[model samples]
Target: MKLVTYRHNGKTSIGKVEADRIIDLPRNDPALPDTMLALLQGGQDTMARARAVRGDYSVPLSEVQLLAPLPNPSKFLAIGMNYRKHVEEAARVGVQTPPTQVWFNKQVSCINGPFGDVHLPAVSDKLDYEVELCAVIGQRCRRVSREDAASVVAGYMVCNDVSVRDWQLATQTMTVGKSFDTCGPTGPWIVTPDELGDPHALRLRMWVNGELRQDDETGSMIHDIYAQIEHLSTAFTLEPGDLLATGTPSGVGVAMSPATYLRAGDVMRAEIDGIGAIENRVVAEPV
Candidate 1:
């Protein structure tokens, strides 16, 4: 199932994607939750209900505004230097690969829609983009083994881990730079685990303006998603609707000989083969 959160006619609701339209789930069954987070928390039966719903009210893809599929997830985390090539690229920018999984928190407030605008903060001009496959947690679990990890993942979405290179390098956590408003752009829709067979074998790419700048495959992750889940869950509970940005591949702007940072008016298109694409335009930060 491809699930989406959208706003139509000034009212926000969750829906299931079918072809180019969104099946209005809440409208079909009044018992259904109106938000993606609530539906996930409703557990398996709610998902089953979402799958079974045949709604007469569906909005054409172009007619409604698609929002971030899971906007208010409890945790919005990402792994850094998890791709060997990206590891190599990081070294060029004076950042090294961690001997262990390096995780960072992208505040939930940073979440933006699939086709939203990314802010070019007045504090920095070193903006960059990283295309990653983001996993949405389906159930609450702890100490999940790598083999059991797939069961806990609800689905996946394409994300642009938009960064402010200067601020990112300024602090070790990479949180402040990563947590800027509108930096985490994800969705188009979430593709359920069953619908997306292998999470690690998809092609991920990002383009700035009209030029392809980053290209790689999910199979290239050094730590991998399962290891990430197992490692993180070991320390705390993994809840439904939480997001895990698996990692991004190389060819980022900061790695270029003459670093190419994004500016206002730049359009970034981030895509994953099985999930979909998200296009965000860079705009000056609103004061």
Candidate 2:
């Protein structure tokens, strides 16, 4: 089932997307949590309840505005150079591939709707895009084994890990460059794990202003989702609603010959097969 957080009639609610209509869970059952994060915290029981919900309270997709499926996740983490080609591309620019998984944080405040506007920050001009397949963690667990990692995942979504190259390179920790407000665009909605089998097999593509700049398969990743969860969980607890971006494949603007960067009016369309697509327009930061 496709779960979504949507705004309709001046109010925000969580629901399930079926065809072009939304089954308003909160309206259908007052006992269900009103927010995605809360519902996720409810675990398998909540998901079962969500699946069982069937009622007349529904709205057409066009009538409601779709928000980030898990708008307020506990943590928004990302992997860097997990894709072999992306690692090779980094090598051309003097970045050495790490021996182990490289992780970074994209502050939760950076989260934006799948169709929201991405502002071209006034502070820098090296803004770039990284189309990544995001994994949504379902349960709270620590030290999860690689074999059991799949059980911890709730579903998947398309994420654009919008970056500021200058700030990123200026610091050892990439948080500053990665955390710019409105930089992280995710959702279209989250597809349950059962619905999206084998996350690594999905084809990922990103287009900037109608030009296909990034195209690759998730299978190209050196360290897949299961291993990533195993690595991260070893260090900390993986909580429900925590988003883990599985890293982007090669073909980022920074890796281009002329080093093309995002400017106002550029539209980025990031898509992953099965999960869905998210399109965000780049606009100049309001003065």
Q: How many backbone clashes does candidate 2 have?
A: 0
RMSD in angstroms, all models?
0.9, 0.7
Candidate 2 matches the true fold with a TM-score of: 0.99
- Top model by lDDT, which number? 2
**Tens digits of per-residue lDDT for model 2, 1-287:** 89999999999999999898999998999999999999999999999999999957999999999999988888999999988898898899889989889999999999999999998999999999999999999999999999999999999999999999999889988999999999999999999999998898999999999999999999999999999999999999989999999999999999889889999999999999998899999999988
Clashes of 1: 0
Q: Which residue pairs does candidate 1 place in steric collision?
A: none
Please identify model 2 stretches exceeding 4 Å from their true place: none
Could you tell me which residue pairs clash in candidate 2?
none
Residue 213 local lDDT, model 2: 91
List the global CA lDDT of all models.
0.92, 0.94
